[model samples]
Target: MFYFLPLLLLFMTASPNTAIIITPNEHTFRVHQRAQWKILLPRDYANPFDPDEIAVDARFVGPDGRELVVPAFWFIPGRIESEPTTRVATDEQLRQASFTVRFVPPVPGAWSMMVKVRDTERTQRSAPIFFEVKPAPPGSRGFVRRSPKTSHYFQFHSGEPFFMIGPNLCWANERGIAQYDEWFEKLTSNGGNFARIWMSRPNQLFETKKLGVNRYDQDGCAFYDALFETAERHGVHCMLTFNNYRDLVDRDMWGPAEWPNIPHNAINGGPCTRPTDFINSEIGQKLYRNRLRYIVARWSAYTSVACWEFWNEQTFTNVDIPPAWTRDMARYLKSIDPHQHLVSTSFGANSQHEVWAMPEIDLAQEHQYFGEGVRDASAPISAMARSLWEKFDKPSLIAEFGIAGEGSDIKFDPDGIGTNMHNGMWASMMSGSAGVGAMWWWDNYIDPKNLWYQFYGISQFAKQIDWINQRFEPVTLAPIMSDRSQPEIFADLIIRSAGGWGKSHGKPIAVLPNGQTSLGLPQYIYGTEQPRYRTQTILNVGIPQPTKMVVRVGKVSDAAVLRVVIDGEPTKDFAFSGLPGAPGQTKVERHPEGKWQAEFHQDCELEVPAGKHVIELRNEGNDWLAIEAVTFRSARSSQYADLETYAMKNEASGDVIAWLHDSESNWFNDRAKKMPRTISGARLNLSVQSGKTYRIDWWDTWKGRVIESREITATGGGELQLEIPPVHRDIALRATRIGS
Candidate 1:
């Protein structure tokens, strides 16, 4: 009987269990992108002799509603790498279990895998776990080929211009990943398509060990995974920044040291110099290379990645670097991930030429902070663009161009803002700038309520202009010179596209006839004057044949007479006084501002036969005139006409004030004392356009109190609303603000 009992036990243990269970009761594996799929069995078991006695079935599904099959396999402990085994009780019997099966998908995409086990007696299945397989990124499209030296142009998938309207995400604090998603989404919905994500050394992979900051762990990976996934879903591109400008200077600050406690020198201490010894050290180079390699390996497959910016504003501290080092760093990056896009550090506009000389850089990026008026703002930018284009002929981008409305004396001017941004775009386009990225979309990070609305307006306008594929062209208009007489004044005549007439395909020729046009005063200038001021007039000397011209104006009545002189002889004097002229006849239209506008068209009998004609205008008996500038395409010359000279009087003291300052502190006191006090309440009177930000500052001198120090966004003309806080006695108030 004992021999028989032993034989029965051996038979029971040897035979496949009527029921099976798997350890790690549940497991998750990413789908599509080739991840190994494994299943654990309750205990090591052999297949039963009767195939019908054992049943195994598995199925996998993806987030996109696609399903896949999982192959069945026997549980072999030693044959396959044995994972930790576990014991579990099923009803009355206890069994040992081991993991089984291995699966790997060749492609990438999202998926879920489920394994079901059943015997003749019962059926049970492991809980299904979910995972994601990212989509393959678009590597290189054949449409535009990129050379080793030339960088590839990026075309946004949304069918819009490659205009990046966004802000730099430089929050150095440990912001929870959940918060990042919310902020990132808000940016995208608000017209931002790109974000600069900083990769801190202390928080990153290798440097974490030294800094005592945890290295790239599951938590960080999960955060990044969610961030990248969310970005892709929202159509936002991330410019992965490896380090801050400060990191480039003092590498040891974030070096392998007490990391979390490692004070940020840029913040804790003053700006410090880059550790050249560390950078040149073998360990330093190795650390740098390893860090970069890890990042590339982890994110190279992400579609939301725009480009890898080597560092943020590397010139912030003026770190000296040998040419060899620059070449070496560029070469090192290229060697690791040749397919990844790259950008050099952004620098001041003046430093563009020197930065572009770096062989590893794909794009020349620059930052500028010009005031809101077009003419004053465009000069330096134009010069910078032209210089870069003439020297390297590479694509350039205005990486940053912004101005704080606070602390500025300038009032909000829509036309001025539009003109400033437009001029920058035109300059870059004409000077071969592939695109322009607006400085920011939102404002006042500390106070979300103070967000800038003008960013959206300007971005919308930019989309329209860029949609036309208008490239800036250099035109040599004889009488026009590029100069700005007043900070507020600006003017430029550019040919967007021309030469549609010749027998051969003629290139679009753009003529940039700037302030130097033969107008009486410079074509563009801003100044304050009495009720009557001299209006500068410009004349077009040559009217090419077969071309048509139209003139548009705002805020002026009594149209200027257009005198056309061909080859130094007076040919015709056409009067433009309305909209849509009559078959080449000059026409005029009235604007909402009660200003009569005039248009002069060539190609009509009213126009002189085109050869070489001088087109000129003079201000004749018009008052209160304001020209919004002009646009001429094709061969005709357009002139500024009908200058009305009128002075802005304070009315109280008959004083003309070019600028007005307003604020909360002295709201009542300042308003009571200023001229024209009785005419209106306490308010600053200044000519301002809709959709601009005006900054004002004031202090309560009487109480030694600071009262109103904030920005006021102007929606339209008239008195702007101010939130004057209660002024406390015995405290002086000093406040300052700016508008966009």
Candidate 2:
């Protein structure tokens, strides 16, 4: 009876373990360009299972269709696992199993892996599970790198400046993956090269206390990994923000406790002070380090990583913590991996002065939201950058700069947004600093019509600049003016080459106007009297007679390399100096009537000579200069005004206004389509007084429709006049509201 009892017990235990078996989980692996793969398992399987105890081995295949085996080893679970695998008791009714495998796919392609589990006692094996791998798609293609020894900009490979033309994308998880995909596609197609992905603190990625067990529990991490994979595939780089303002230690880490607080206002609610030895004391840092280590070690092998942003707008909050804490955290990251990738904080400020000064920082990042009327804030901001460059002498990048636009108004005058960005970029580039132009609300929040078009324009401009860097050598210039007076006179020039001699043999020059005058270039003398103010006219010199000269005016940006062609021929390279020199037979001369005119050879060609031309005379090396209006002439005569002429007529005023046409009156006729209706019939009459500015607002009741609004300043009369468009139906008028 005793012997039979022992055998019965053994049979019972073995029976449960033998009958309950799990087949390998089938997985489809898809990675984009420059991405890697990693698989996590349950904690029970931390140690390798005996071959006889398992049904199948986990194997991964490469792009070459070859199988690669992962080394099996036990790892400390840290905060991810609560107990050691050996501590877990096994019974016949159930047995726990866990393990993990990691692999980095070098290129884009379909990949497969097989997972099988074998039972030794039963001599049975589970069916093989298949998984696929994908590479980074067309638009996405870079990764972030971090270093401790130098600032973030130095981390980027020299000559390969990381230019991110992207938007601030928030509420990603709430938006879901499909919307994310569409947004990514739109941004990438429109010339956006990167996305700033946010990860709130107390999120699932940091919940696990142990590695294997906790990693398995990280659904958020899994979701983001998928998104990262998608971004990589799309050729879009991601600046993954570690935490948002609400999730920080100094703020409410959980819930919307401060919902009513104004958006950029600083509110300290959470435990702002962290332990001195956080990594060694708190369980969270260990988990954080582990997760970060895993992330860095895995993602570092891919080229898609352009930079690793530490936090988003952390400087805005008044967190009571020593600066060394951040410094240490940065040091810890660099110790694990030293790659040529930039590491920075998504902080809003003149980063060149504050953040760049931190030993832990690489690039200077800032966010600008200057109001509408003060459209040219870029000037001062850029001037500050120049001062910072001279002071710190480090590489800088404008991490963020944008404007709040309702719709098409913001799009066209995106100059309101673009000018600031363009000027900032110009300042950075001309000052030898890396520039990152940011678009706010391109996706995720405000859905604007022609949003993609705006992005495309910015992207094209950036690409042109990039092309310039590839083609010509970059030579920086000193600011022409040190004072705020006559900002229009400051000019930044990039000359292709120096020293020229003839009409056809003169060097070509590219000029970017910063202030009123054309830098210090040469001006013609009409009658040897000093000119009162600098003008946008080219002064002729060394001419013996009144002669016709072809002048060209074109848009030149920091992001593009432009080639100037006179007529059908290219111009010779020339240096960009504040002073102009006489070339070849080109001479400044007075007419028989004692009037001076500049002349070019009859065979000289001109590009963009369609606009009206005027002649100006100035004295050589003297303050005397005079402007004379000449007859408007063009090679192709036409009475039609250019598009700019028409647009200038409808420019917005201080008060809110809308452009409505009578083409479609449904917007005016449909009541159900109007809610908080700000637009209606072709003619919109609203009571607006003079000297007041109103905000234009609208809502689209349709499922995926968009509503737009523009503001018009009141001319001081009791009635507000507006040119309405017939595109929309119902309209509601609201007085301008200010002061929250």
* Model number with the top lDDT: 1
The global C-alpha lDDT for each of the candidates, from Candidate 1 onward, is: 0.39, 0.37
Supply the TM-score for candidate 1: 0.42
TM-score of each predicted structure versus truth? 0.42, 0.44
What lDDT is reached at residue 291 by model 1?
50
Total clashes for model 2:
109
Residue 143's lDDT in candidate 1 = 12
For model 2, the stretches where C-alpha displacement exceeds 4 angstroms are 1-162, 201-217, 249-287, 297-303, 338-340, 349-360, 384-395, 403-433, 444-446, 464-740
lDDT of 2 by residue, 1-740 (tens): 01112222211112224232323332444342332222232212211322323323345566677664332211222221211122222342122223333444434455555544434343332233344456544443233433223232332222344555666654354445555687778878877766666655322242222222123222343455566667766767766666554443333433353222211112212111332222234544554555455555434444545666766666544343245545666777766542434567754531323445776666555555433222232332343334344445345554555442322225434323233333333333333344444556544233443344345543543443332122211122211112223222211111111101101111111222211111122212212132333222232222222334332211111111112233334443221111224332244554443434343222222223332222232223222221111111222111110000000011122222111111122212222232322322223334445556655543221111234456655566744454433223222222242322
Identify the runs in model 1 with alpha carbons over 4 angstroms from their true place: 1-152, 156-163, 172-183, 200-223, 248-274, 349-355, 370-376, 404-431, 440-740
- What are the per-residue Cα lDDT tens digits for candidate 1 across 1-740? 01112222212222355333333323443321223333444433232211234444456675667554443333211111011112222322212222333333323556666777666766778777655555534531111112322232345332334555555554323444444566666766555566667665423322222222112232334345556667666666677766655554433323332222222222333122234533565555654665555455445445566667666555553555444555677677766552344555564412544557776766666665532222223334444444445455455666655432232212322222233333333334333344444443222231143232323433443343332133333222122111123132322233211001001111111222322221111221112221223333334434444444433323223344434344456555444334344333355577655655543323212334545444433333333223333343344222321010111122222122111111111112322333211111222233334445555444332222234556665555633444323322111111112322
Worst 10 residues of 2 by lDDT: 640-649
Q: What number of clashing residue pairs does each candidate have, in the order they appear?
A: 55, 109
